[model samples]
Target chain A: MAEPVLSIRDLRKSFGALKATDGVSLDLRPGEIHALIGPNGAGKTTLIHQIAGGITPDSGEVVFLGEDIGALGVAARARRGLGRSFQISSLAPEFSALRNVMLAVQSRQGSSFRFFRPVMKDRSLTEPAMAMLERTGLAARANVPAAELSHGERRQLEIAIALALGPRAFLLDEPMAGMGPEGSRALTAFLDGLRHEAPILLVEHDMDAVFALADRISVLVYGRVIATGTVDEVRGDAEVRRAYLGERP
Target chain B: MSRERAINLLLAGLLLSVPLAALALGELFYITLATRMAILALAAVGLNFALGLGGLVSFGHAAFFGIGGYVAGIFSSHAFNQTPLFSWPFEFFGSDQMPAIWLAAMLISALIALPIGAISLRTAGVYFIMITLAFAQMIYYFAISWPAYGGEDGLSIVVRNGFPGVNTAVPLIFFLVCYVLLLAALALFALVRDSRFGAALQAGRQNETRLAAVGIAPFRIRLAAFTISAAITGLAGALLADLNRFVSPSMLSWQMSGELIVLIILGGTGRLFGPVAGAMLFVLFEFVLGGLTERWQFFLGLILLGVVLFARGGLIGVLAGKARHG
Candidate 1:
């Protein structure tokens, strides 16, 4: 009922012959987790890349907060509240988990051109960064570098960094890609609660987590949305069952 | 005390006391040698800001260095001749004032860095390195062909430039001046390294995509760092020209840039005191080896090869352990 926080319309991208993303359109409104479910090479990540301003679409419009943002670069889009998380866990590897989150906090605070004052002593940056780390269950490992963080902790740190941006919507690509069963369950619960703070356009392969958390489901097959509906409606869709669900149905 | 803190204190003490001791013993040549170390250390300190922290391997920093030297040489020459630098718009007479010349050098270097960094930061990897080197070569050739300022023969100052409250013509006084500037620049470097901007710059170096995703433009941060880096280098260049009473195309040569980088790596890249240690070692090698043989650079090359191949962290890393964050 409310205006969508993010709207992607008629997005198309191609690599020579293969149509990576072909006329894909989606919208994420406030207070909902819109799960994008697909098999391998289904163009889920490419579509996320387009929406997050990582890659330019051959033809499309990405509207954020009712403004066309197709021309903005990744940093500009981020400053406008388009938060992104990578499937491969992109982070400052040498920086401590706290410093990594503090970067996000500093970004959210406005111009980071302040040069004389020591950032480590700045409570304004550190306190909120610590809070975010605590929220993601990374408080204990705050001083450890991201390179040394456990796989699950790195994923949690990514979420904490995204949260620090005060994003209007989350473009999370495979947030649970490397997680164990327990980590997945915990993150699923965490993400389900996070949807109340901001809408999430979650691209994931973890069907169990997707089923438990998605307020609405969209099945992407070969770069096209084959079906969009409640879990039961999408689960019963014949094309999705044949193309994606397969024998599991 | 921590080994790093101990080494830091020892370095400060040695740098300060050695020159003062030379002054006490009337070893004027040693004072000059100490002054050379301080000046060269200051130059590498400027390079360290970009190469060490920002991870910008600038191969043309000698362009700024030469610019600073030229600023000092040109201004003092005009002042000595009692000629206005230009007749149009106003009588712009040159100044022998050290502070004014340093300001001019820094401003000019920063201005040059703005355009150079804007174009260079667009690229990364070897392209960035080659482009920067190419820009420095352009300046070097320009200086060579510009006959008004002595061309390839270079410009020389008739006397050392003036600094307030100090007879900069005195060898010991000049060494003290250089020493004080080196310490001030080191303090500034430490402060900048710990700032929020420094955090963003380092993060940009580590993972640019992550930096961009967090809403900080890597290009802007790097451009700022490069500009500041050049300004510091340029100031050191002016002081160096004053020390030698000359400015030449040799200062703009690519070898100077390589030597600056050598000092950084030889000390420890990204470590605060790395340049100081490297400069001391380099000058000492030049002195001792030069005394022993004519082919000293050949031996110096051997030592540099050993450091590169075997001792990855350089003299400071071996002596002081790992850098605090590193």
Candidate 2:
């Protein structure tokens, strides 16, 4: 019922002759997890990149919070509250988990040009960063370098960093990719509560988590969304089953 | 406190004490050698900002060094001849004043660094290194063929530049001034490292995509870092020209740039006093081995190979062990 926080209209991208993203359109609303599921190489990540300002669509409009943000750079888009987590854990490998979150917190606070004043003692940064780490249950490993963090912990760190941005919308590409069963259960529960903070445009493969968490499901195949509806409606759609879920005998 | 911090204090103390001991014994030559070490270390400290912290392997730092040297040489030369450097810009009379010369050197080097960094930063990895090296080589050749400033023969100042209320002509006093400046630069480096800008700059180095995703542009942070690095190295260059009372095209040479990088690697790449340690060891090798035989660089080469292969973290890493937080 609420106006969408993020809308991608008729996005298209081509790598040589093959269209990676061909006429894809989607929207994420105020407080919903709009899950985008597809077979491998279905241009799901490509579609995500297009919206996150990494790849430019040949012809499309990306509207965020009522403004056409197609022309903005990646940092500019992010500053406008478009939080994202990479498919492969993207982090400053040498920095401690706390420092990585502090960077995001620092960005939210203001200019990073504040030289001469030491950041380590700045409670303004450390406090918020510590809170995010705590929220992600990463408090104990706050001092560990991102490189040393376990794969699952790094995923949680990514989510913590995204949370630190105070995002209006989340572009989380495969948040549960390398997660174990226990970790996935914990994260699915965490993400279940996170949707109220910001609507998520989630690209994921774990159908069980998707079915459990998604308020709306969009089945994408060959860079085109075949269906978009409530989870029950999409699951019942014949074309989605044929293209992605496969037919029952 | 931390062992690294304690080791840092001891290094600073060592730098200070050795020069004072030389001053006490009237070993004026040793004082001069120490001054050279301090100046070279200061230059390497400047490079470390871009190279160590920012992960920019710039091989064209000698351009900034030469620009600073030329600034000192030109200003003092114009002052010595009692002539205006340019009458067009409202009769600009150059200065033999050390502080003013240092300002000019830093400004000029930073100015040159801006365009070079702007262009070079568009590329990454080996391309960045080669483009920077190419720029320095161009300047080196420009300095050689240009006839106005003595061409390849180089320019010489009649006397050492003057500092306020101090006899800079005195070897110990000159060394003391350089030593104080070196300490000041080190303090500033520490301060910047702990700042928010440093966090973003280091983030850019470690992972640019992550930096961008966090709403920070890596290009601007790196450019600002590269410019500041040049400014610091420029100050050291001016000090060096004053120390030797000469400025030559060799300051712009690729070999000089390589030597600056060597100084950082030999000490400890990113450690606070890495440059100081490296410079001290390098000077010791040159002095000790030069006294023994003419082929000191051959032995130096062997040692450098060992450092690169086994001592991956450089001299400070070997002594202090690995950094805890990375």
Chain A: TM-score in each model: 0.98, 0.98
Q: Give the distance in Å from residue A183's predicted Cα in candidate 2 to where it truly belongs.
A: 0.9
Score chain B of candidate 2 by TM-score. Answer: 0.97
Candidate 2 chain A lDDT trough over 10 residues, lowest sum: A240-249
Model 1 residue B199 distance off true place after TM-score fit, in angstroms: 0.5
lDDT: worst 10-residue window of model 2 chain B:
B317-326
Local error of candidate 2 at B121, Å? 1.0
* Error in Å for residue B227 of model 2: 0.5
Model 2: CAPRI class: medium
CAPRI accuracy category, model 1:
medium
lDDT of 2 by residue, B262-314 (tens): 99999998678889999988988999999999999999899999999999889
Tens digits of per-residue lDDT, candidate 2, A100-167, equal 99999999997988778888799999999999999999999999999999999999999999999999
lDDT tens per residue, model 1, A32-112: 999999999999999988887889999989999999999999999999998889999999998999999999999999998
lDDT value for model 2: 0.92
Task: Pick the DockQ winner.
Answer: 2
lDDT at position B95, candidate 1: 93
Worst 10-residue lDDT window for candidate 1 chain A reads A240-249
